[model samples]
Target: MRRVWTSYAFRRILQSVFVIWLVSTITFLLMHFMPGDPIEIMAGRLNSAGMSHDQALATAANIVNYDPDASVWAQYLDFLKGLVTLDMGNSLTSPSKTVFDHVMEYLPWTLFAVGAGIVLATVIGLSIGMAAAYRRGSAFDHAMTSIGSFLTGVPNYILIAAVVVIGYTVLGILPFLDMRGRVTAGVEPGFDPVFFGDALYHAILPIIAFAFTATGSFLLNMKAATTEVLTEDYVTVARARGLKPGRISRSYVGRNAMLPVIPQVALQMGTLVGGSIVIEQILDYPGVGQMLMSAISDRDYPVVQAAVIILATSVVIASLIVDLVLVKIDPRIKTEGQDA
Candidate 1:
């Protein structure tokens, strides 16, 4: 068992490194060759504010570590060296801030919102899905399945826009919910209830948008898994033994049905940071997605590169962790791996 786990971990680590390196290289190349120049954009803004063309050009180049005169090969080599040393350097838009600083500043809030949304979606999905399976083909099941399908198809940003418009125009109320930001201004940042409550209040719309859209897919998956498990011979044996229906549903059917969903959850975890970009922008939420959008608009290459690396690395690591967890949870996986 130890040997198997050790081998698995070692293989996964190599795979993760390769995946991250590939993604990082692609992102770096794209950012470098993209039409807009961060230094030129910065120079333009500075020039507008009365700085001489020469001064603005020099300042911009210094801040972003880019020189139009320098060869692309030289720039690429410098970027590679910085990456190897874990030095992402300064942001072109905000020269005072390092790439790591920007990531640390915005990533946690995204994690909070996305993590809460995923958990909420999972609970709601699994509960409704299991019930629908028990009543498969009934009116209730059809109703739930239909709603889930519709919700799954709708994009989360659309949901956010719709809710904002409805809340303001139709309902004639807006401020009561504190619909933007991680917290209301003037609230002290702490572990206190007031601060926490305010943060959660501001997060409600973004969270709802993510959870509602995410729930539909999770619901459909859970329902399909439950349906298949319900027809299994073990389920039949459980029913024939005069087992209580609820026990059979919960223990025999529900437990087995959840196996497939575990992998889906891992994939969701991987994408949450990257996937929240649109919804976060619509809701004005402070998160990695919002940060990435702002950085892109400013042509902040280092920040953009860092954000892409973070998201891709998260996906690779999450997948590896899920693989190991699945192996632990299912003996069939172990047997298959051993045979291989």
Candidate 2:
């Protein structure tokens, strides 16, 4: 067992290194080739105040605290070196905060929302799916399938937009989810209850949007898995053996049916925090997704590269967890001598 785990960890570590490198390279390239100059983003107010474009550009360079005259290759090397120090340099938008500091402030809140949404979606989706499969052609099955299909067809951003308008305009009750918080003018936040409450209040709409969009896919997948499992030979045998329906249902059907979804579930959950940028921004949730968006808009190379590396790390870790879970749930994984 120790040998198996050790081998698995070693393999995952190697994969992680490759993923980080790939992500870093991609992020660097994207930021490098992105449309619009960082100077424009940095000197927006100056431009509005009638600064010439050339003047604006130079000012932007000063604000970025880097010599834009440097070769792209040299800038990239510095960005990569910053990764080693966990120094994401400065954000053109925030101006004052390093990319690392900015992301760190917002990541936890997004993680909290994504974590809750995943747990809720999986539990609800699987339960509904199994019940529907058990009832195959019943009214409940049709109802759920119809709803799932309806939700799955719509783009997630639309749902987020709707949630924002409805929650704020129609309901007129929930507090706005401002990126960061709704602090008194100029007051710094220390994650106190006030800031936390403001964050939570705003999280509601984004969470709902994410959950709604994500639930449909999980339900559809689970339903298909359940249907297939129900028709399996083991399930047939269990029924023939006169095992109690619930036992046969859980052990014979649900267990095996859940196997195929294990990988997808892990991947989706891992991505939830980083992937819901549209929803996060629409609802103004202070999360990693929004941070990535800001980094992209500002052409903050160090920040973008660091965010990509973090996301890649998360994905690799999730994939590793999925593999281990697969081994545990299905001993027939045949990993014997090929432990890793």
What TM-score, computed on C-alpha atoms, does each candidate reach? 0.87, 0.77
For all predictions, the C-alpha RMSD in Å is 3.0, 4.9
lDDT of 2 by residue, 84-200 (tens): 787756676676887778778767777777766777778887888788888889999999998878777887678767765776689985445343332334545676887666555
For candidate 2, which ten residues in a row score worst on lDDT? 177-186
Where does candidate 2 stray beyond 4 Å? Answer: 1-9, 32-78, 93-96, 166-199, 334-340
Error of 2 at 74 (Å): 6.1
**What is the alpha-carbon lDDT of model 2 when measured against the actual structure?**
0.72
Q: In candidate 1, how many Å is residue 117 off?
A: 0.6
Residue-level error in angstroms, candidate 2, position 179: 11
Q: How good is model 1 by TM-score? A: 0.87
Q: Please give the range of 10 consecutive residues that has the lowest summed lDDT in model 1.
A: 4-13
